[model samples]
Target: MKAIVKGALAAGVLLIVGAGIVAGLRGSEPSAGPGGAPSSGPPRQRTLTIAAASDLKFALDELLKEFRAKHPGAQVQVTYGSSGNFLAQISNGAPFDLFLSADAAYPRKLAEQGLLSDDVFSYAVGRLVVWVPKGSPLPVEQRGMDALREPAAKRIAIANPQHAPYGRAAEAAMKSKGVYDAVKDKLVLGENIAQTAQFVQSGSADVGIIALSLALAPAMKDQGRYWEVPLDAYPRMEQGGAILKRAEDPELARQFRDFLLGAEGKALLERHGFFLPGE
Candidate 1:
């Protein structure tokens, strides 16, 4: 009987010890490091990928800085390119949470194709401009599109109208001004408006039709002079944005969309020389 009692006591002690260890472990925080300090790994953050039009390159950069400041735990990555190409990629399953197109037509098409989580909405109106490097021999500002016809203006850069909205606008403007046929031979196409600006700035092209927002950016502002293409020269460049149907976080995407449509976003767009829709 004494041996049996001793064995039972040992078994009970083992059970109690095991329960205590489990309880201690369950109640304890993560393991500590040297000096008994709790280890702090990187904080978890939600990430969002925004596919935006090239015209928004500078504006979006500034807006995102403010957005991250407002939501410190949120991470945003932007890919700036031609809106038409972005739409095609998104349709083909590009992993983008948001799409901001330079023209509303692309987003509307996405909506029609069931690629959008919600209805597309206008964000801003884009403006096109003719940019010539400062001190260019051709008087682009005074002569406008006519400046391209100057002998010194041998090369002119414009975004590829095949996929870039700004390029289409540039083409339309030139056509309306009756200069397209004359200047078409001298045209050098950039992949996007940003690249078009670079072509002029880098002296690869004597002139470029680029986004007004880009011309207003500090990098280009000091290096060139621009003449805003009259709004009537081309159709309105209504820019739009939408959340993708396959977004990883629909609510987060919606928040971003709302932010862009909100006052702060509108103010930023205006500061960047973009006109709000209906303005």
Candidate 2:
């Protein structure tokens, strides 16, 4: 009986020491968070960086908002500029996860250079417009590209043809309409289509050749009127995008690319005045 009692006492003391050791260790540990993981703090956010064409500002804004709602963990950063400029930047190793170009040729060029992680895919067909502020008497809606030659239009704004696809389109449309030679001396250049629209809006230029998407944006729509440039006048502005070979997260870039190509994104782009690829 004594031996049995001694054995019980030893076992009980061992149990107590074991329990105390466990309690001490638990006290030393960080408290478990909601899912029983040590509370290291909030989970790290997944970041996606995109270089996009200026024409997509309004439409991409809404699309990104929807994407964020769907992916709360994702943080997307976008830089908008001329497609050619972005292409140069990406080629020089700019840290962009995705590149959305106003012209597919830019992305195709990147693909040829072995810089793209994925195949170039068309997103929308961009169109140009002759835009003038509502108060301006340019008659752009009636005369179309011909209005650029009007006496009242002392200054006409267009993106720089050297780098901007829209600028090239504007030049082509004017040339096609036989107005290029007449108004060539009156042209002002913007860094991109958005800036071109700003020139007309601010009265810095009497009229602007800009993207139809910009002319349809809420702010631009309220302040200006526009006429769609004839499609045949300029080469088709088939916009496209590609994932970068150096993307920090290729899968995340791909997911966003898929979202942009999805039906919801298509509807949003259409609402912003972008024509769908098929229609």
> Against the true structure, whose TM-score is highest?
2
- Local lDDT at 17 for model 2: 9
TM per prediction: 0.84, 0.85
Task: Give the clashing residue pairs of candidate 1, or none.
Answer: none
lDDT of 2: 0.80
lDDT of 2 by residue, 62-140 (tens): 7887887777667778887878888888889889889999999999999999998889999999999888888888887
For model 1 the local lDDT of residue 267 reads 96
Off by over 4 Å in 2: 1-42
Instruction: Identify the runs in model 1 with alpha carbons over 4 angstroms from their true place.
Output: 1-44
Candidate 1 lDDT over 1-279, as tens digits, reads 000001112121111100000001112234576899876754344667888888787787778777766666666778777788888898899999999999999989999998888999999999988999888988877999898889998888888888889989999999999998888888888777777777778777898899999989877788778888999999999999888888887877888788888999999999999999999
lDDT of each: 0.80, 0.80
